[model samples]
Target chain A: MIDAHAMLGDETYLRLDADELLRRMDAAGVDLAVARPMGAGMVVDHRAGNDLVLKAGPRIRGLATVNPWWGPKALDELARCRDLGAVGLFLDPARQGFFPTEPVATPVLARAAEYGWPVMMKTGAYVYADILALAEVARDFPGTTFVAGFGGFADQWFELPMAMRNAPNLMLDASMMWGAGIQQIVDRHGAGRVLFGSAEPRNRYAVVLKAIERRGLDESSRRAVLHDNAARVFKLEGGRP
Target chain B: MRIIDFHAHLDERWLHKPIPDASHMVAAMDRLGVAQTCVYTMMGFYAETPRNNDLLLERSQRHPDRLIPFVTVDPKEGPAAVDELERCLERPEFRGIKFHPWLQAFAPSMLEETMVAILKVAARTDTPVLFHDGTPPYSTTFQIADLARWVPEAKVFLGHAGLADYVDPAARLLRDVPNLYGCYCGSRPGDLVHLIETAGADKITFGSDFDPGSWELLAERLDNTIEAGLSPEDLEAVLWRNAERTLRPSSR
Candidate 1:
């Protein structure tokens, strides 16, 4: 299975490099994982972490993250990151402390859409990255594939399933969500737009994987969420790099 | 060892599908080997606090052995809230109190007078109070910590243990607040592990946030607890012993 989200960086908070993430993937039965940069890279320096992800080897693909506050610098990083083979763009409003709908993010979002990179936003920060606000941004950039990471976790799903209907470009990852919630979303929206992500180190892969397995989804929806959806969204070939 | 889930809910509005009674909750508990589950009314979170509390009372009365009811109050009701809590405590079936500051849309910071009265009532009765914590502007771990400090005699639980991002703050607060404890409910396994490591295993009780039409939710929470890699003694504390102590403080 392809883990739709994870972080790889040698930062003080969660120092997970390629070997550690790959080791975790092997243990969790994950074939490939989309590795995004975390820590200082998420908020301050984007190039160092993006470089780390680019060199994390085949099993770990890179997701480029930049602080939307970085403005033109963020666009340059996106261009450099795309050329460096980063598979997608990750925007963390919580860490960077910006409302996702801020005009500053528009240029970054537009740049990513221009490259056809799926944009995954770290949600769950109330008004800053509220899922509804992300939905509005998704509507603004209809061509960009937007994955709402954690799907507005910590009690934001109350209206998100319905919100997905209005914005076709908006998708979700099953990280930090209850099993029943993920099941309800898939049942309501179908598994084509939902991807499996463990958010490991912050969350456990094995525990979340077990939660998904025991939910009793049909094999088709299960495969779509666990592998196929991520492959399609992140543009992985054969569920791997 | 018996497992007692300290947090579950009984409100059809949030259940998605129809559930005629508490049998589904009991059946799910039985299948998972959970001995008892403390149930609160989720509908009370949105509206009809007393009516939903009565509904929970009736449901708990039906399966006295398997379901433990926690009463809810719109503390904004002031004296009426205290009276309702006192009335509910008249029956031993109601073991604790549940509050959802975020969902109930009443921050304890804003309703200080009502909160003080309710906390005093819980303290006098030796009843544990569980707060749906981990959200901001209302139910952050620090905000709950203030309540715990306000009524140091009362047993206050951070119901979700700071959920996704607040676990660290919850753990930090647990270190300073003697009356404050955590429920291993909504926070992920890694956060739970950190809570256990930083605050000690004795500070937390296992909670599934389980409700009807969500049996798999219980299983997933159980997986989270087990995945935290607690030793048998620590697991026992989180799964049941800590909850038992909190439920019946006399036993402690």
Candidate 2:
């Protein structure tokens, strides 16, 4: 299984040992992690951490965070991220406290299209509704794939499954899947559509993996959500350690 | 490793009122292989006074091997707070105290005298005290740290201490405070790997803050933490070891 979303090294590190963070990912059986930049402050830090993860090598798939404020500079980093070994981009709908589909986001979307990279957004607990505007953006720019990183918080499956019901190019990551919305996601959408991801600090990945294992899904379906889908989307070739 | 879920809330809304019974909570623990949980009740937030410590005591009677109960009290009522502390100590079922100083509407700093006095007894009793700090009504980590300094003997656990700001502040306070440990329930994981690597896994505990995040949110937090990476031993500490040392012994 593949972790569709994750951070590079230790996020929120202050006097923290970066290697330890990598060690944690290794221990969790994550073949590759899509690490992102800190919310807003880490525009450059995102690049640096991406560089750090790249230096650490392939197991770390870097995801760059751009300051919507950075304008074109943010777009420049998109290629920088790809060069730095980052596989995609991580965006918080509320990161700069703006909508992802806002006109201001156009440049960033263009950059993703330029790199043909997947842009990730955090959506939890019916977050799908809030991301519909983002869906419009995804639809407009078919070249740029928008991954609803958290699948809009996996609430009642009412909004989460429905949001993704039609968007095949749009993938929803269940990285932060908890008891809150785990069952409904699997029940309504099946494990095939939801990629495996443990928000790392939210809960133990083993817990989520175990939940999926014990749940009604089969091994092949599990492998698709856990590994195949992420590998296919990110084009990661067996992300060997 | 004995589990200490330092940040979980067992509200009346959980399963039922007065005492919400989540037999499933124990079931979840059993499934995830958690040994014990240091739990508090939300009913304490609504009523005039704190909820009885026996809320956990009742659970321990059923699953002594897996559950540890903590006292959730209103520290705002001055001396009466001491009375509640006495009640908690009277029963061996409780080992620590859980307070939502934010929701409880009490200044832990202003209550230093009361805290020092109560923590004095807690020191003697060896009962650790866990307080809600981050979300804030009035209590802050700086303030909670101040209180911890005054009461050197009482082990102070900060429930969501640096989480409200959720950056280096929470990580720093968690490491700096000697008596204080943090409960990671509602806080974001963006910085959590840093907390575990820097703070020493023993200081942080896992909590789901379930009712607010969703009953199964802890499952995700566990997923994220594990994915963030740590050695088996360190991960075990965050999940159960450190908490076991602080909470389980006193309750017994």
Candidate 3:
């Protein structure tokens, strides 16, 4: 299964020497990993880690880390990532220190939509408000697909139903929080809108995988979530785990 | 093998909403082949009523053998927190106390003075303290680590030890600390196996933050762990024994 969300960009978040992390990914039963670095310098030192994942020979695909905080760097990384066979882009506002819809980010977001690249925004514990903001952005740009990582934190309990009702293109990944949140998201949004994501190495992927398996979802939906949805969203060719 | 899930959640999403009841939880457990579970109250900090606590206590009491309740309270509520702990401890259903410093917006270090007082009560009453750990840069691991050091006698459980790859720091905490027992509940199947191999499987607990993902992720983790060739005994220790050792007041 493809992990739709991963920070391959930032050196700080993931410094796993490429071969080692890839080995771990295999052990985790992850077939193809779609990842970007956490922040900007990951782009600078990109070759060091990128060389490792790139040589993964289809077992891994790299997402170029764009510094949304920097217009030039952000746009530059977009084209670079597209060329690198990256299927998606990972963005974190808390790390970027600016909201996704901020005027400065408009150029980057617009560029991503132009290239038909889906933007995965890291929602830092904001409940529904952050997801709602992403949905608004998606609505503004019809072609853009906004993947909200950590979608349903405690704060968003009331707003998720409404958020789902409003934003059809907004996708949620089940990576960070487990337990009731998974079922709630699946129930409200359906399996298609939900994709599987395990914040690797940081969070144990096995436990999250088991939670999904044991939650009693039907196999078709399970297969879709475990890899299919992410594959579709990211346009990845990785086989199932 | 009686698998014990050290991590699970009961939140507002499940409280007034269409949630898995004791039957639903048990059915899910049976599906997962889990024998017992230590369920934490994530929503309790936000809950305004004593009724929420009552509902949780009642729910746990209903399935005492299978589900062990970990009472959650907001220390910000001051005396009310103490009262709630007293109330929960009086009941046999709750195994011990559960604290979420990040959710409560209180640093674990700041709560120590009060936690020390509570730890004394916990030691007297023979209950342990359960703390959530997201590690560095998400939340301060040291906050919980500090609390753990201060109350050496009180067995402390730290959720998310293999925290997404905060493992270096989390691992250091696991190796360095004597009283702290960490539960691996983050993503990535290999991480758990790696930690299981690297840490000798003695310091970790298996936690599936299930019900969040339709159950596939958690099940995959457990299945992968078994596939990695852990002895049934080590598997039991990770999936049940360690948690049983940490959460059981009488075991201390």
Which structure among the candidates has the greatest DockQ? 1
Question: Could you give the C-alpha RMSD of every candidate to the true structure, in order shown?
Answer: 2.2, 6.6, 5.4
* TM agreement with the true structure for every prediction: 0.94, 0.66, 0.72
Calculate each model's fnat, 2 decimals: 0.73, 0.44, 0.29
List lDDT for all candidates, in order.
Answer: 0.85, 0.63, 0.66
Clashes of 2: 35
Superior by DockQ: candidate 1 or candidate 3? 1
Q: Is candidate 2 or candidate 3 better by lDDT?
A: 3
lDDT of 1 by residue, B104-206 (tens): 8888988888888899989988899999888887988889999888889999999999886787889888877999999989777778777888888899999
Sort the candidates on TM-score, descending order.
Answer: 1, 3, 2
Query: Model 2, range A60-124, lDDT digits (tens) per residue?
Result: 66677776666777777667767777677777765555576677887887777777788787654
Candidate 2 chain B, run of 10 with poorest lDDT: B11-20
The most accurate candidate by lDDT is: 1
Query: Would candidate 3 be rated incorrect, acceptable, medium or high by CAPRI criteria?
Result: incorrect
For residue A52, give model 2's deviation from the true position in Å: 6.8
Candidate 1 backbone collisions, by pair: none
Candidate closest to the true structure, highest TM-score: 1
